[model samples]
Every structure is written in C-alpha cells, then in structure tokens.
Target: MPIASEPGPGAAPAGADPVPQFSEWRKGVAGVLAKVRRVEIAELPDEPEHLLDETTYDGLTVAPLYTRRDELPEHPLPGAFPFVRGGDATRDVHRGWYVSAHFAGPDAAEVNREILAALGNGVSAVWLGAGERGVPVADLPAALSGLLFDLAPLALDAGAATAEAAERVYAALDGYDTASRKDIQVCLGAAPLTSRFADAANIGLAETVTLAAGAVARAETVCAITVDGTAFHNAGASDAQELGASIAAGLAYLRALTERLDIAAALGQLTFRFAATDDQFATVAKFRAARRLWARVAHVCGAPDFGGAPQHAVTSAAMMTQRDPWVNLLRTTLAAFGAGVGGADAVTVLPFDSALPAGELGVSKSFADRMARNTQLLLLEESHLGFVQDPAAGSWYVEELTDALAAKAWEFMQEIEAEGGYSAALDSGLLAERVAATRAARDTDVAHRKTSVTGVNEFPNLAEPPLSEQARRADRIARYGATFEALRNRSDTYLAEHGARPKALLVPLGSVAEHNVRVTFIANLLASGGIESVNPGPLTVDTIAAAATEAGAPIAVLCGSDKRYGAEAGAAVEQLRAAGVETVLLAGAAKAVAELEDAQRPDGFLAAKIDAVAALSGLLEKVGA
Candidate 1:
C-alpha cells in the first residue's frame, strides 16, 4: 500500500531531493535534525499578522507553532519503534477518503430515509445521532434495508447513556450478516463526562466501547471513545481544554479498551474522531499531532506494532451559526480541506443549516453537501491535493507543530495517569475541572480581545433578520415523542410572520477569476430567479473593505479566487463586527471557496451551487429568525 516506489527499484526515490543530496545528518534512521538550513519565511518573522501564540489552557502552555524538531527525541517509522504513520501497512487506502453523513432526527423512518439518500449519493460510512439514550437500528430494520451504496454501511456510532441502552442498539446492528450484509460494522459512543456528571446522568461510556469491541469484528469498530470536543466547545470548552481533555479521553479509552479487548485489539480497533471548524491550520496541525500521539500511545501500551489508527473528522458545531446558516457550508468546506489534508480517513461536512431550526429552512441544505463534496472533487481532480500523501509531511512548521502536539498531549496523558488513569481522573472531576478552568480563560481571552471570533464577539449580530427557520428536529422529535393522546392534548397555536430583507452581493477575490466568475453568474442567476441579488464590484482590497463596511443587509455574497485570498481579506473582515452579516459567502465552487476562508478572517467561503442555495434556504426556513 505504500504508493508504489520510484520507477526503478527505488530510482533515487522522488520528492524533497534525498537529504544526503543536501545534508549529512538526516541520513540515519531517526537522526536528530542537526541542521535545517533556516531560510526566510514569507509568513513568519517579518509578517505583520500573527498565527502562532504562547497562550495557556488551564495553566498549560498551548503550543502556537510546532516545537523545534531537533530538540525532541526521535521515534521510528510506522511498525518500527514508534509507528507514527501507521502500523505495518494496509492503511494506505487507495485514494480519497471514506464518506459519511450524520442522522439526528427522532423519527426512525425519516432518519432511515436520510441514510438511504446518503448511501445512494456515495457515503461509505455513517454516524447515527442517537439521543443520550440510543435508538437501535435493530429497532428499525426497514431503515437499513434501503441502502443503495455498499452493503452493511458501517454502524460506528449509536450513543446511549447506559450499557443496557448501548447494548440494545448494538444488538440491533449485530443482527445483520457481515458476510452477506456487512452490517456488523459499528462503534457505539459513551456520552462525555460533563461538568455536572457526578450528580447528573453519568453512564457507562467505556462499557459501550468495550462491549462493542468484544461482540463485533476485532478489526473494525473504533475502540476509542470520542472526547466530543465539539460538544465541549459548544458548551464553551477552551481550545486547550478541548485538546487536552480529548487527549486524556483518548488515553482513557486506549487503556480501558486494552483492558477489555487486549492491547492488540485495542490498538487495531482504536481511531479518533475530531471536529474541524474554520481554523484551517489549527485543524490540520491538530490531526497531525493526534496521529503522532496515537502512535506513541500504542507504543507506550506495549503494542508498538499497531499501525495507523483511523481518524474520522466532522465539522464543528460551536462554529456553525444559526443566523447565517448559508455560511456554514463555506465554514465546513475549509474544515473538510483541513481534515483531508491532515490525513483523516473519513470526513463529514454537516449541512450549513445544522445550527438552524431544521427542515423549515430554505433548500440551501443541499448546497452545503454539494459544496462539501464538490470541494473534495476540486481538491482531487483539479488541485491534485490527494495525488500525494502527507503533502505537509516535511513542512518545518508542521513537523515541529506535530511534535509539539504529541508532546503536549503526552504530557497531559501523563497528568491524567498521575490522577489514577483517565476513568479515575474523570470520576474525580479532573477532566471537567480542567476544562472548566480553560473555558473561563478562553472566554476571558475572547472578551479581552486576546482571541477573536470574527462574526461573534467583535462583529456583534447587529442586524437581526426576520424568522428564517422553525424548530425542525424539535418538530420531528415532537412527532416521534408525541403519542396520539399527547398530540391531541398538545396546544396548537400559530402566529403571523414577517419578511426577511432581500439583497445579494458577489465579491470575488483572486487573479484567476474563472471559477468565481461562474459562481458570480450562478449567484446572480439564483437571486434573479427568486433569491436576493447583488454584485459587489470586482474583488479589490479597497472594494471589499468598502462593500463590507457599507453593505446594508445581513447577507453578503463575497467571492474571491483562491489566489486572491489571504491575510489581506482576513484583515478586512477581521474587524467586520460579527453582528452585521447572516451569510458571508465566497461565490464559487468549494475548490475555490475553501481557500477563501480563515475562521480568523471575515467571509464565508462557498460556491453558489443549487444545493448550497438549498442548504442555506433550509436554514433560513428552519430558524424563521
């Protein structure tokens, strides 16, 4: 699986000119970088804008960039002393990544319908959004039978509060024949240990992973329990806390799974799920570090032979805003790019309107998915990002950052171990206490302007648009939860509605404007055809700034070619009060749009595709804001 070596029996192996051709020190296995030949960085030293930092999380220093690689001890390659890249082999998946779509609705039939839709459309895996108490797929067989994609779509996640509930869910999935249906695929998640767990509903989460591994294929089901970093982030977990606590959670799962299934199965079945938002580089670096640490953990557990662990990434919920739901597509696109580049085996880009009410929104829902998928298409077919593996493998900053992440996570893991292992640490409230402390710090930083959320803290939601969505899932949940008598007894009252303002502007950035031009025309067409319409003048620093400042409506249809975007645009939107806009979109396909977004910057990056439009409209209709 190692990407067939050079033409000849290793014809001088292409790429980064053999180190011996330039340096002598790097010739040995795991040789410490004696010299790296420092060169000028267009982004570092002289750059006015700052990307790295020395901030702290719960008093722990959060590495801004990576640490000096030469300063750290070295580990062997995959299957060697460290196994960082992966285990022996078999991990080098042909190309692209496993696909996925999440289902969270209360209705069994409706959620099943979504599963079928995704499968037919090309999703290889799924994450069932069971409530705190799981709804077993076994409880609903009709839903699973509609698959149009591959057979036995992986049954990885079935969330429930207790072991009993999780078992029921798995029992339902295990009903399928893996040989014939391959439905045995699965990973049941345990709810996160929240700040109020001791008194609240703390159930057997590790029990679920252990139980699933014991019953299911030892090779499949990810043995790791998700930290639900996004769940914590949504509840206000700080960056470092999200990172630290997740690392701790991962370690806990490794130890626990190893206990139940042994180190071999624990390492083989273990995988990590992360949330990627608009923080492009951070998202990338986070995964890189995660892979590094996971390998180390396997080694530390005496399972040094375990290869690459699966890393599945989903977009962040905390970052998705219900107000400007259309922008979510753009946000997720960059997140997807970060995950894919960071080496995730699977990536799920949520519909932008996810934060919104639900189905009540406009059809903009499809737009989000289309853009997400098409963005990958662009990266693979046009950008050739997938042609090579670990494109960022040798970046000085990336490598150093990866090392730093590994070190930090390892440090935190040690701290957790000191607290009597992850589970004991959780039981003692260490994880929650640490996260709480970090959350407070992050809030302070945001409030004090040490950190900025473009459209949130700084750019307040100034102009409130009319009702754009209704409680979509809430309604569905009600439908499912409501019995005949309950429905009959429930109050039925309706109120009059108001109208949302209509206006659209196309702002395209970059020197090569072909893609954006098409997107602009599409945006204009969508607007004229019924949606609001406006075209910002050709993308220029002055024009973008002027339009951003003077724009009246909550939605600004911003467009820019990949080449045109960077800190300039980021700077322009850096101060654009988060309050003013509902949607800050990049008017083009995902390929171009993903490059346009920087969570630290101003605009939503996405193409004006019909699905993207539908997805945005879905949010608007759902929230009715």
Candidate 2:
C-alpha cells in the first residue's frame, strides 16, 4: 500500500504543512502508548511501540513509519542515464511485462500444443525448458511448428547445450517469413559459469559468446548470453549475493565477448535472470538495484549509452513446498507482482506443484501451467501493476532498500572482481562458501520457526494424504523445509509399516488453566515431528505415572506453568522414571524447572529457543518414530 502524504481530516488547518503534522503525530502515538500502559486509556495495547519496529534479513532496520526525511536525493528519471527507475523512460506502461510460460515436457508435440494453448490464453512468451528433460535439440522443429515467432518472444534454457539449442531454435525459425524472422526476440539461456556452479558438464562460455555475437548480427532482438542467478539463488544465496554473482557473471561475459565485438554490441547481447520470492519488497529492490548496478558496469566499460539490463524474473523454486503445493500459488502471485512493479521485462511463474519430482499427467500439468500464466495476467490486466513507471519510485522504504541492497551487492561484486572475477571466485569456492553460510543461517531460522513456511513446518495438515512413491521425484531441488519434511515422511513410513506413530504421554502437572498453554505448545511441537501426543487430562504425579504405565508410551513430556514446573517437575520425573518411561522431555526451559535437582532433570528440553530440527530428530530416533 502506498504511504499517505496528506494529513488526515480535522487535525490540521487547511493549507498547513505536512512535516510538522507528521512530527506531532509521532508525539501523539507516544502519548497514547503512555496512557495505555498507565491504564488511562484501557482500549489501547500496552507497549505499542514494539509494533513499529522490524528487522530485515540483511540486518537492515525498517521503521514503522517513514517521512520525507527518509527519502533519498533525486536520481535520474526512468530511461535516463543510470536507468535506476527503469530501462525505458516511458517504462512500457502500455505493454506491461511478458507472461513467460515454460514448456518442459520431453515430447515436442506435447510442448507445441501446450505453448499454443498458453499463448491463446494469457502467456506472452514461450520459455522452452532446455535439457534432456526438456525438448531435445532434434525435436525443436516439432516444438516450434505452427508458432508465430514474431508475435511472441521465445526464451529457452538449454543448460550446457545452449549453443546447440540456439542453433536448433534458429533452424526451426526457417519456417517463419523472412520479414518476421528479423523481428523475433529470443533469450538464449547460455551461462557457462552457472552450469559450472551446478557441476554440469559441456559448459562453453566462448562458444556461447560466439553464438551471441552471430545472433545479434542476424537479429537485433536475440540476447545471446543469459546471466542466470537461479543456481546461486536455489543454493540459498542472499539477495545481495545473488545480485553480486549475476553482475559479476555478466561482466565476465562482457569482457570475453568484447574482444570480438564492440562494447555496445556485446552489452546488447546479454539478458539477466533472477529468482523472485514472496518477500515483495526485497524482490522489487533486488531487480531495481540490478539495473543501477548494471548501469555502473556499462559506464565503467565505456558503454554508458547502452540500455539498462533487461531482466526476466522466475518465481523462486526454493520457496515452493511439495507438502502443501497450493500455497505456491500465493507465493508466485506475490513474486509476479513484485517483479512487474520492479520493472522486469518478463516474469515466469512456475506451476504450484513444480517442486515435486514426480511427473504430472498432461491434464494436471496443463492446469498448473495455465495457473502460472494467469497469475501474471491478473497482475498486469486486473491489478494494473505495470501501468505506472516505477510504482515503488517515490516510496521511502523501497528507495532506501534499493540503495542499501545496491551498496551491499556492489561490495560483493567488488570482492569477486578482486579475486579475479566471477569464474575465479566460483573456482576458488568463495561464492559457494558465501552461499553456504547464508543457507546455514536461513535453515536455522526456519528450523526454529523464526521464518515460517505455512504448510511445511508450521500449521501442517497432519490429516493430509500421503504422497505416493511413484509421485515422489528424487531430482527435485532441496528446499529450506526439506529436513522437516523428511522427519514427517519418516513418521508416515513408520505408520504405514507398523500401523501407528510413536506416542508421547503429555503430563500436564497442574489445573487446566495452569497447564493448558504449555500442553498445547508441547502437543503442537510434537505433532510437527509426527509424534502423536496422548493426553489423559491433567493429573498428579501418581496418577500421571499410572496413566503412562497403562498407555505404554516410551516417551513422556511435562507441560505446565513455570511456577508449576518448579514446584512439581522433580516429583513428576521421579514418577515417570519409576514407571519405566525411556525418555522424559520438559516443554519449557530447564532453568524454568527450578525445583529439579541436577540429577532429577529430564533427559532433554523442548522450548521455543532450542534447535527444533535437532530436538525433533533426536526425539524421533529415541522413540523409533
């Protein structure tokens, strides 16, 4: 939502300035919070100030409120030098972004049918998935049959076989009219460094550059070298890291190609692809920052007049979850919106179930592809997101984020350059090391619920049907929630083989009011790891021990208020141990159970602060769940 610059009704006089009014508003908020804490105004929440502060992943602080003071100094207009706002000064408001739909089926005929249907619906571009899994080079003629290449831009990702793939595409275009052939636009996804990073063979950077120079000479619209950051992004690189890697890779390509072609021609032969996630502000800022950074690169290379880097945004595969695949629609929608608002020339939203490794039937696959196309259509047509030039242009938050991201990314790019550029950094394992550190930090956050994935680690649907083994593809990219999903899957396997998940007896050691909160917390926590909690109502130590013995559960967990835990936990542990409970877990912190002697403490603790993945894995192994 756009921030309101005008003062609200009735508070300030007509024609009064907004700056002082905004300052007065801040004071009013403080005054109201003071009144609420003092109980003068019982309707307001106490400590409302806490609601206004937030921290971003990069450690950037976001204020609840922003004023004109937060705005950056004036920059060049859209399509101007630097092109921070956008590539075109007019910003293609009338055309909107291209809705690129990917066709990855192996059968060329099926891919052709899918592409035609996609274009007839809402897709503006055809993205042929390149590789053995996609349309083979020999099948390009069949895939391109009956397509009007001039009308829709064609983009393909062939991985290491990019040169051969590009040739196949060009050969297939022989069917198009000579006049229309010159107008066709194709983004040749040929990034050698990206292939090398993924450990794929047949990466030919020089050959790809050679092909790009030829394609540019033949057709002005064909981009020969696509600097893709999807591999780095899927590997869990931070936003700055992804940008840095992409820019450095692009520069490397520019340096190599310029030896044979002019700087401007070399620059025009490049296209950049970045992953767009559900973090709307960050995605938007990353794309915008990319343009600014590229402009600087071009300027340094004596090609300042070259246009801004054209960007293609693909909705993040890393963010897609296989468990509750429907949630991916929302994720893609937000990503598409961010990409459009951030001035991406095109955006591709992957199907909701794309994260699954199994093959989908034609009917189901078509449905998913249609949904992906419609997401971009809805954003551009109904939402009209692309009608405005740099919709985030004047917002203080976006501007600040853009600048900060650019600075961080620029630093990373410089570091890579200092180490002899992108190829050198990747070869030396510096890029991988950086991405690994970020991934570790991110995984820890997801494990502890600091970052929540709706249907995976948090609020999981325990009743959901099991995914069939045939439908489970082993080749799917790893996601942040993979570890948690593994735990759940193991429990599912155990249940199928043995008829039940291991049960945990929850001993709530106080009255319902005293123990209900912790009981619920512990139950949900255990459920996250597929451990069923058996609650026979709140009970005393003797009753709890009798119930545990009757239930025959190998594990027992105590749940109660800190005061109750301190008073009764030691006795409860002794009773549970006497009843032959193999392991005892406390719902709260160990220090919370003050009355428990060092020898009387439970086997382990399950609290909000602990590493949830480790705790749950340990519990599952102990109970054979």
Candidate 3:
C-alpha cells in the first residue's frame, strides 16, 4: 500500500509535466528524492503499519509521528502573532451549545407545532429553512402562551428586504412579547458574495449584520449573517481550504461592519456553519482547525478576544450514499462525532431519509427535519461526547495534521495575498479549480479500487435491492449563498444543461438463484453502458448452458449468493455442462466460490460478493446488448 515519502521538504512534485528547474540549488536542498523505506522488517509486532494513519484531507503524506518538537515552519503565538493554538486564552465550556434545527410545515400553526415540539425535545434554536418570508408568528402571543418553553424561530434567505418588510419582521416578534425574547435570535440571511453572479440583488449581508447588531437589545440574541462552510466542503474543499474561505468570509464581513458596530459584538452574532462528512478525523480536524484559523483572522482584524463565536455544523448531505442506506447512520455518527470533538457550538445530523426532499422540485419534502433535529439530542444526551475539549489534542498524528493543515492553508492564503486576497482568487476561478481537482482525484480513486470503502467499493452484494432516497444531503436551500457563487441563479439552468443522464438497468437477483451469472452478469451490465463483454443470448442460464456445450466444454456457469451457491452449486454446473455447458460463476465470494473452482475447473469464471458497478461495467463489456 500506502506509503509516506518524506513530505515535500523542498521543491514541487517530481513528475510535474515539465519539472521545476533545480540546476543551481544546494545539495539535498531543492532536488532531494528521499528513498521510501517501508519496513526495516514487516514481521515485527511492534511495527505493524496502519494504512489510514498517514493520510490527510489535503492528500499530504505525513509521517506516523510529528510533534511540537518536530521541525515545522514556525509561526506566532495564540492571540498574539499567527494565532496557532487559539486566540485570546478563553474557550467556551458554557452549558455546551444550542441545537438549532430548521422547521417549516404547511402554515404557522403547523410550523408552531414543530417549533414547540423541538423546544420540548431540547432544540434550543430553530432555523426556518428557506422559502418563508416573515417571522412565522401568526398570532404570535397565542403561540408563545401554548409553549412550555420558548424558542427562537430564525428565518433565512439571500436578497435585499424592503424597508417595510424588515420593520414588519421585527414588529411581529415584538408584538408576540414572549419572556424568552432574551434568548430569541433573528438572522437576516444576507451573506456576502453568497451569490456573486447575481448582479442586481441589493443584498449586502454586512449591511444587514450592521442593522440588526446595532438595533437589538437582546444582547444574547443574534442578528446573524451566516458564512456557511458546507458550500465549500460539498464542493470538495480540503479541510484547510474550507477553513481559509470561511475565515476570509468572516473577515470580509467583520472588516465592513466593525466600522459601525464593534468587531467582537458583530462577530458574536455571526454563525460560522460547516458540513460534517464521513471522514471523521478530517471533520474533527476541520472544526478545530477552523477555530484556530478564525481565531488568527480575528486577532489580525483587531479583536482583543477571538473565541466564543458559535460554530454551527451540519452533517454533509453530500457524503450520504444511496447504496447501503442503513450504513448512513454509521456515517452520520462518525461525522457528528467529529463535529462535537472539534468543538462545534451546535451539530445537526440529517436523517437517512433526507435526499428525497432536498432534491424535490417545487415540492420540497419535509421528511427528515424532525429526524435531523432529534439526531443532535440523541448524541448530546446519549453519547455524552460533550465531556471533553480538543479530544484529539496532542496525539502525534492529529497534532501533525493540524499543524500541516494550517501551514498548507497559509501557503494558499499567501498566494491569495499576492493576488489581492480571497475574493480576487474566487473571481479568477482559482478556488474552483483547486476544489474540483481534489474531488475528481478522490472520485477516481474510489471508482478504481485504489481507495477501498468497505460496504461501498469492496464487498458489495449484487443481489441486494437497489437503495432509494433513504439517505441524502441534509436539505440545503439550493443554489444561493456565497458558497454558491459559481452556481447561483443557474442551478436549474445547469441541471437543464446536463439533463437526461445515463440510465442503468439494475437487475435485482433475489437473495440467490441459479439464474444468476455473476461475471457475465456484470460484464453484460458494463456493456450496456458502452463497454465490451464476452457473452450473448437472453441473459438466461439455459442459453449459457447451450453456449458452453457449443464451446466444447463439459461444465456450465451458475451464479448466486453463498446461500444459494452451496456444494450443489458445483454439481448443478456440472449437470448443465454434461448436457453441453462449460463454466460456473458465483456472485458470492468466500470459500464457496473457491470451493467450486477446487472441485473442477470451468472454462472461465468470475465472482464477486459485492460491487454491482464494477460487475455491471464488466458484464456490459461481454454482451453489447
């Protein structure tokens, strides 16, 4: 496997199309090609290698151990210079974070019911996921009277508001007169460059932040201008890139608003949102790194203290796979755990049944909001992960990765600095290219088997039923937000442009049956998509038997799961071939497929326990039809 060649100690990658010139550098200075030494000896118990221990979000090759004592590019202190450890020595251990869940039903009464239920179930804040324009309080006083506990129902959007509408939202809530106004928060969803491509919207997120921060007396209440890191995460940003972009966004808003309201006061209301994906360490490292990164930016921006602002994290909708739906809970757990460990002020996990709604056109499904909300409560109370701080703190690998990420991100930031900064980089399409390249590389690795995801790429059951919308991206308000700068105002258009995608005929072979032919099946499947295959006929066993006989073989092909492909499976292959058939293929692996091969050799055989995609791709090649 996976090997770590002493990471880039000097120049660029060796095979970079046209190599960098290194004719006049010091010996071992810019052209050192350190030999990769895996084992001083592999049989030793003390030196067993772990493949995952050395990988990183940026694809950097890190050693098994790195530390503060290790040679690192030096930086300044926390809250003083570069702000690596953190900013201002203070950290939040306050009754640990609000569980903010978004809720929207058919109307106010229906919506109020969800809000009240959430408050009852421990959701401290409520985000009214896009499409509702006013403070959802129709008869606000009555709604408050009914609730045992008070809740903040926040609205979201990305556009300028008329003078009247803004006043109406404030008045509607004021008229409600709930004692919990002390805890109630309102956010004007005006995030900057949230939609850079939209030329006409007078939506200045910084302006809205200033307006609300200046007016509100509920010092605890937020007039938040969200900087969603999820947008960049889903678009394939490495943990460092995601953190840098978020820092820049927060700074952009802070630089604009500190002129009006004090910087700390404005930042206090800002919510930095991120997406928690399946890669737990990366997710954990992301939030912690984000905190450290933001702390630095805040210090540079002249804030005396740079901690305590809320970090809102949502489990990524992108990482949820449609193929083993139940495995989604495991994925969500890993991601949510990362968010919690990395110090999220709040975390939300999307239900296994979210995509059906987030992807709907015109009729957004509300299937998972309640489930998503409950996920946080389940973790907060059940898992009890709240009992620690920077949990992975000093572990050699984590620390190394953390420092490595900071340095790599700083390098990118320096380049941006040379080009006038983050906004300029985004405008020039540099950001998109960077994230896209990472995504393509990862996707290619997954497809090729270079990176094996257990239930996904490696051991997959071809006979298993295809998955539906049981799991999906937590519902995102599509195509708007600074993260959507490249995609805004054109989601539907882009979808239209790439319309009518590839169609695959998924053959669901019930648990196991003799009718199944694993290799030919996959090869045929692959062939339908324009790959080549080595079979013909009605995709039936009788036809396969006939072909075997014609090929002058005394064995036939039989394919099915272990349950069906027992010892008799070989016997049946022989019986069919005696009647003029020639090979047997078992979709199930393990000793069963091998046992059949040991019993007697068929002309050719291929078997798989999982991997419908690869199998199908292979099968498609065998039979053109």
Candidate 4:
C-alpha cells in the first residue's frame, strides 16, 4: 500500500557521513525565507499568512515551499503496484502517448473524410461521436468506411445510444480477419452513470450493465466501458470529486462485469476519462492520483497485479472561453503538456475555437482540427515531452500533491459509498449539491477578480470585433468567463442596433501622471463589460460639466489618487451631476468616497478586488446597453 519508495535525506547509507554542504544549504534557504517574511510582513502586517498560504478548490493547502524535510510517501517504481508513477514500466521514447482527435458529425461522408485526414496526419486514434449529437447510428458504416481498424484505435462516444453504436461498429469490423480484429482497439464508451448524470432521461443502469457485459463478451480488443468523469468535472466538480466519482463508477462497473467475467478481465474492460485543465501542476497531480486510487481499487478486488487504469485526458471544455478564443491554444498546450507528463495513455486537445459555432468566427473546422492535433505532434516531436518515463516522479511538490489528492479522493469515494453508491448519490442530488457549492466559490473568486481570466476579465480588448452569433459549445458546460462573455454578447446586440457601443465618461481630477493608473484600471474594468471609456483627460471643475456634456455619457467615473480625490473629486462630481451625468462613480476605495461630503460623494466606488460582474452589470444597465 506504500505509494512510492525512494532515497531521501533519511535514507542515507548507514554510517555514511552527512554531506558537509547540507548545513550550508539549510542556512541559505532560511536566510531567503527571512527576507521573504520581512517583505510580506511589511506589506500585510495584519495577515502576512496570505503571502505563503493558498488553498485550491479541492481544499488542498499549497505550501509556498516544499523540501526534503517534508514527509514523503513511499511509492513503488512505475508499472508496479499502486502505480503512482505510471501504469507502464517503460514507454517507447520515440512514439510516446497516443494522439487522439475528436470528431462529431451528423454527416457520414464528411466525418469519414475528417477521420482519414486525421489518421494520415499523425493521429493515432479517433474518438467519434456516434449518435444523438454525432453521426446517426445507421450511418456508422459509411462514417468509418475506409478506416483501417488495425492502424488507428477508435473510441466511440454515443451518449444514450452507446449499445446500438457499439453494435454497428462491431458489425463493420466483422469483415476483418480474426487476427485483424484482435489488433483493432476500440472503447465502447458505455458510461451509464455519466450519461444519466448529464441527462436524467438517459438509459437505465441495469440495461446499460447488461449491454456492457454482452459487449465485453463480443469484443476482441475492445474496452467495453468507460468510467467518464468529465460530466462531473464540467458540472463544476473539483479534481478530487471527479476522481472519487469516477472510481466509484469504475467500481460499480467492475462489480457488474465480475458477474460475467473474472476480476482481471473486468479491470481490463474499463478505461477512465478525466478533464485536463490549464492548471498544469494540478492536472498532472490529478492524473497521477487517479492511477494510484484506481490501482488501490483493483488491489482490493483481488487483482493486485492488474495494470493501472488506462486514462484518456481531454482538455477541459469548461475552461475554454468564447471571447478571444485564440488564447485557448495556449491553454490547451499547457493542459496537453500536463496530460503527457502525468502519463496519460491518450490525450485529446479540443480545438481552440470549440466554444464558437462552426464557421462563425472565421475559423474553418479543418484548420481548428489541424491545430489541435498538431499541438500534440509538436510537443512530442519538437519539445520531446514524452522522452522520459514518469517525468514528475521525483519532485517533492508533485509527489506530495499526488499523495494528498489521493487521500482526499478516497474520502470522497467513501462519502459516496455512505450515500449508498454513485448512482444513489446522484439520484439523491448529493453530488449536485457539492458541485454547486464549489461552483459558487469559484464564481465568487472570478467575480472579484481573484482569478484572472485573460481577455475576458483582466486586460480586456473592447475593440475586438464581436462574433456573428453568441458563442455556442456543444457540451453546454458552464464556462468560467461566461458572465463576461454574456455582457459582450449584449454589447454586440446594442452595437448592431445603434451602430455604436455605450460609453462611460471618465473625469480625471488631477494631472495626467497622478490619475493615469486609476484611469487605466477603470477603463479596463469598463471595457470588460463591453462599455467604452471616454476620457477627456485631466479636467478642471469648470471643464468637467462641458466634457461630460460633450461626451454625452449617462454615467461618469472620477479617476484620481487619494490626494486628488480629497482635493478635487467633490467639485468634479458636483459639476458632472449638474451636467446631467445620471450616475456618478469614484475609481478609488470606499473610504475615499466616504471622505467626501454626503451630498457630493459619488454613487459607488470601483476599487481593486470589487465584484466586477455586479459593477459591470449595473453600469451596463445605466448606459442603456
């Protein structure tokens, strides 16, 4: 049950003299920490803990520093029991992990063309959407017409029609020789729990279990079930929650399969799917912990020597933004790197333009698909990311995170078991309740700008042209920047109706140098809500009324330093009000607003760390947007 075993400070050879430089290294680290603490205390004397203390949504406290002094867990080598390092003992340095591309099609010929192109262009696997939102079940043959079964592995995501889709795909493979069929790898993707969680009306659990058993019996090289965690992850489950729910689902499948097959065969029949996010270290740790947790499950099921769980990592759809979607390329690159380094067997990087409707953002589907696949190719060929086994194996931070995350995930699995099981918990709404709480906390952080989402919340570019339609994602996961994107959509509507965007008049009360910083801050905040800022430069009280009138803005914000606010903001607010600026606001803290006479104080303050969504929403309403 030990997670890993490695030499550390305590593992020095018996009677071996301690390294003479050890004391010196400790002293050097202490000296650096002293200086850091002094600076932190000076900045936040009352709460300096904030400088070195951070906690993730999963409730894991991130230490500012980790060292050999930390009690590290003992893990076996890669491909060993518990498999924290990796499932495989070694991998081909040249080939690395599988590069999988996703294809969702309602047309058979079109999907066939894309599949062929993807395979020809370095894709090792194809994840086809086979029914409902994808290719019709009847068209599965045409969609897979020319696909060479032995060359490219196939993964099917058929939602409610998984049984029929799996049947059709199997039927297509009947023409191949038995040896060829054995060489073909397919994932039947029969995820009843994920499907039912995503939609209440999905197929029943007993039926799905029966179908999966039948498929496993019929399959040669097919994984009859996938314990997909993306539904919970997209629904705002934290990393630990996703892992726990997935394992619970996996266990449920194992139990069902054992009724027909042995434990080892059942274990081999299931694969796990997790979402890979831009949080690289967390993503890496999540994947590592998943293997450890699932390995423990197999060990307990009397299959101690079974290989670790096969993981398929898909870049998070929830993290993709509809605005400035080009940034998604960067996001997915980091995520793919995490997935690769964390030892995922296969990774699917959703196209950067995934949040936009096809062909609506001037990006062709073929171009986007090519970019997504090539991202992995470049990482594999150019960056050589997969040249090593268990790349993060020895890092103190990663190992400790992996251990702690596994513990937390195990606790969540226990909670689900206590609530009867994964299915029972989902039916009782326990899973949804927990996910909602986590989502609320995340939304609060985003709203207050504690979490910066580039191009949507921080450093927004209002001048960027709007998409022709509101952003549409097939998955329907709630994006982190959706609130800001909604505001942008409203601005687009206003612009199309009136040929111009709503504007806010910024009244600066001091010299440009004294007010420029606040001016920039206020302007960026306003633009994030799709409103433009019309700054008339540093204005005198006498000029404020005329500037507000000339700008013709219903809302005016005073931008200045605390000194300038005390000296000139009162007069500026009064003048702007006299000029019929319906809503007057200040750019500084609430204390600055209170320092003004009650009669002259602006309506509100736009200080750092304010609830940006609420503030922007109020401003948009006042500006008639």
TM-score of every candidate:
0.59, 0.90, 0.64, 0.92
User: Which digits, one per residue and each the tens of the lDDT, describe model 1 over residues 1-625?
Assistant: 1132224353345553523333332232113221232433332333211233454453333343332232233334433434444333343334456666766555778778777776666666777655443344444444455543234334434444434544554445555444533323454445444322323344465555656465445333434344455555554554444556666666665655665677777665555667776777667777767766666666667765673566778877766654435656677878888877776777787777665554545655565555655665665566766555556665656555566656676676677779987678777877667656655555445433345443332232324233432432232111111121111111111112334334455555555453456554545333321234455546665566466657665555545545554434554454343435555554544454344455644444444323332334432443342
Decreasing lDDT order of the candidates: 4, 2, 3, 1
Error of 2 at 462 (Å): 1.9
Position 54, candidate 2: lDDT: 80
Clash count of each predicted structure: 61, 1, 32, 5
Residue 52 accuracy (lDDT) in model 4: 64
Answer with 2 or 4, whichever has the higher lDDT.
Answer: 4
lDDT of each: 0.52, 0.81, 0.52, 0.84
The 10-residue segment of model 2 with minimum total lDDT is 1-10
| Cα distance off (Å), candidate 2, residue 218 | 0.8
C-alpha lDDT of residue 539 in model 1: 61
Model 4, 1-625: lDDT tens per residue?
5544556666657555445455565555555655866643234434333356689998998886666545476577778888877888876678788999988879999999989988999898899997785899999999999888887789998877878887898889886555656768888887887777777234556666676667667646788788889988888889999999989888777777788788888888889999999999999999999998998898888897885868999999989998888899999999999999999989999999988777867878889999999999999999998898678876889988888899999999999999998888988999889888888888888888898889998888887887675353234586788888888878887888889998899988778898899999999898889998998788888899999989998889898889878888888888988899999999988787566788899899998889999999988887677
Give candidate 4 misplaced runs (Cα > 4 Å). 3-50, 71-74, 178-181, 200-202, 469-475
The number of the candidate with the highest lDDT is 4
Among these predictions, the greatest TM-score belongs to 4
